[model samples]
Target: MRTGNTTMRAPGALALAAVGVLVLAGCGAGGNNMTLATGSTGGTYYPLGGEIAQLWSDNIDDVNVSTQATGASVENLRLLDNGENELILAINGVAANAANGESDFADEPLANPDDVTLLGNVYPEVLQIVATEDSGIESVADLKGKRVDMGPPGSGTEVAARQLLESQGWDPESDVEAFNSTFEEATTKLSDGQVDAAVAILAVPAASIEQVATGGTDITMVEIAGEEADQLMEDNPSYSTMEIPEGTYQGQDQPVQTLTNWASLYSTSDLDEEVAHDLVQEMYEGADDIGHDVGDQLDAETATESRGPTDLHPGAERYYEEAGVLD
Candidate 1:
């Protein structure tokens, strides 16, 4: 309910926003300009990505850092393929889709594109679905003949929602009406009873879900059930089990089951290995300067586990291997 809020960029803010841009490479080789393609400015990816961009700008004298607003997974990957962005923060499962050119999302059969390289993992994203209690939809299959918003077009949430629905034999176009709107708009529709459900895949304590819960309309989170969940875990190694506790989303006191998404840093092969190495090193070393809450995200322990199935970029591989994260 709180997303899509007006994120005011201060006057001349974009220019001065460079407190974290262009990490000055005082002792080394030439500096390289780097851009991080992050998700909707309204969501977690924006600030988190901004933190990284600033980290590079503030610490590494070898790179000029910038963060571009993007549509989370699908669009970020597209930007990478089109050479629009030098770096991207992708959902692990969605990254697999882009790597393989897998579904209707890409529809046009791609020739196994693989120009992107993985830097490492960032954090975990949960599949958080909010539905009105009045909708009478109790399960994933219950979504049939109902109205659902699958997040925005080209968003990681949209792709994940559709695929999970499809694997369950539900049709996005026919089984349920699908709307491609931001969580803010979708929540309004849901509150108005114009929509039956809305899906958002983000970290917990999500402002959007809190909006739905606190809005006076009763809500429920569905559990991704049975063998399909298992199949998804197997088919997509990046997905892992996550249980949402009751009361976490507006006092709906029952555990909701689902899979979680890992957010990973992906880059185009255009990046030089040494530059990539330095980028990884700087991210880890300068974590503290990015803001404590964000700094915690790049921590040495949990961060490494966030990179799903993608192979770490050779530069990152060297760092991770040396750090005892990889063999």
Candidate 2:
């Protein structure tokens, strides 16, 4: 865990400069400039966002798209509300929290939460709980009094982790020893015995988690299922049941039913409808390129799937209308 250095990293200047040029060249007289905010370089969002921006830059003649690496979910939603980024990849829970002024958003609520709307769903972010074999943490209840990394500050993983703890009647203030760090750092702590367990909300088969699994540390993937999982879904509109299939990780012999939510693309209400339409259309048209470059989660059907709790952006609505999907 990085001490006294928890602030989110700023966007790179060189990337911003290149996007400025692209905006100047590609935009029409009105100037359609946009930025897509993703997560840290280590996670799925950064690379996936880069591919999306590339698709938009190449196909949309009237808009210029650039990508920035951010702190994921909560930070991305805040950036979109503040006009720092036009589009963002956010977890459903974080988005819901921001809109409701709950959880991370409780301290500093968005000025106008409704101004943000969903463009499309990219993939499912699974709630993953990894613990060491010696820690004896086989389930959520075993986490009491144990040292746990709740994920990076302001991350959606933290939000999900907290929800799980609260559902189990454990107060984060007194029931557990909590640490805040990036999933990569937390994985190291778990391996070295500095932490007993680590909770992360990420796409399945995470490379960072996989790294620890192969690093000779005996690990266990804790199940977040059964009655508690059902209660969690009932309590949070953003959550849904998901499964981590057998063998997705090393020595995981059974499918773990867990909670999951979509990782979705969102846009501000201010975006020109036509520009938004073009962006969504081009993304779907170039779906195969994205699958080849990133993951297959952005396939046409999944891309256009209903983003629960995420209101469809009118611009995206326009595209879906033309594509004969949004009846």
Candidate 3:
């Protein structure tokens, strides 16, 4: 939705360039075939989603696969709940919230609990705080009475950022100045000293966060460790202990503590079992340099992290069982 005079490679170009793809077994048209809903074009989900869609198309027969650019995690789940069950890339946190119908989306589960499943932990996303040293903001506790960008309205980052704030006992509405600004706007406001801090939720090795760090703002990250954090994790199983290994950001001397969730691929319950199985099997086997626009954060070890969520689809169950990955 953003038109730019400047082009910064549009995040996931190579995969999108290869977009006009269909499922492997010539799975006919898009009416009932599998579909995937990714995030905004400027974000990592889009291109990574394209590659996953391509993988499904190439592996499964007679099951068409396609990708649609959407408002990221929450919208993806909403679509699935409404019967758009192809596939989606979402923050582990959003997936958990969507699964249980708690917190931000406390109305109800978007889809039936059994209809969704975790494809895998695609990557580890970090909860980050960026600010100038002179801003006098250092930890989560100091965030009250300051301007912060939790994230966009429909994005996964917003959902997690709000939870992190509430866990710290900060009143997002009354105690602090909170705005759901875009990444570009947030960074610009921070650089201009108009905003005291930008609270973000993103995967490790996030290129956008790295760029903000490099923008001469005396960038430093906060360690979000405590019993409160543990409570947050306990309340939402999507998040687990996250660490920013030294040199992860531009100016960190040692590890910084954060919470992260698996960035997973998901599908609706309607997906045919054999087709879903083949799709998962293909993604597991076809890791390559797909060039995600937000940045390439994939690797051999990460792509195969063990222990995904409990809501396993029948098709993916077959893949895991057959690969000897599940017992």
Which candidate tops TM-score?
2
Better of 2 and 3 by TM-score: 2
Using lDDT as the measure, the top candidate is: 2
lDDT of 1 at 35: 65
lDDT of 3 by residue, 1-40 (tens): 1111111212232353367432322244532255677776
Tens-place lDDT per residue, model 2, 1-327, is: 101111222235356655663232234563555678888766778888887777776665545566887788999898888767778999877887887788888989998798889887777888999999899999888999999999877778888888888887779878999998887788789889999999988888887788888898888999988887877777786788888899988888888878888888888777777777777777776677775334566654666553655578888887777777777
Global CA lDDT computed for model 1: 0.72
Model with the higher TM-score, candidate 1 or 3? 1
Model 1 per-residue lDDT tens digits across residues 121-198: 776788877889999877777787889989878888898888778777777788888898876677788888999888
Clashing residue pairs in candidate 3 (N, C-alpha, C atoms within 3 angstroms)? 11-293, 12-293, 23-57, 24-57, 25-61, 25-62, 27-62, 27-63, 35-86, 125-203
**For every model in order, what is the number of clashing pairs?**
9, 0, 10
- RMSD of each candidate relative to the true structure: 6.5, 7.0, 7.1
What lDDT score goes with residue 187 in model 2?
76
For model 1 the TM-score comes to 0.82
- lDDT of every model, 2 decimals: 0.72, 0.78, 0.66
Off by over 4 Å in 1: 1-30, 104-106, 109-112, 234-237, 288-295, 301-309
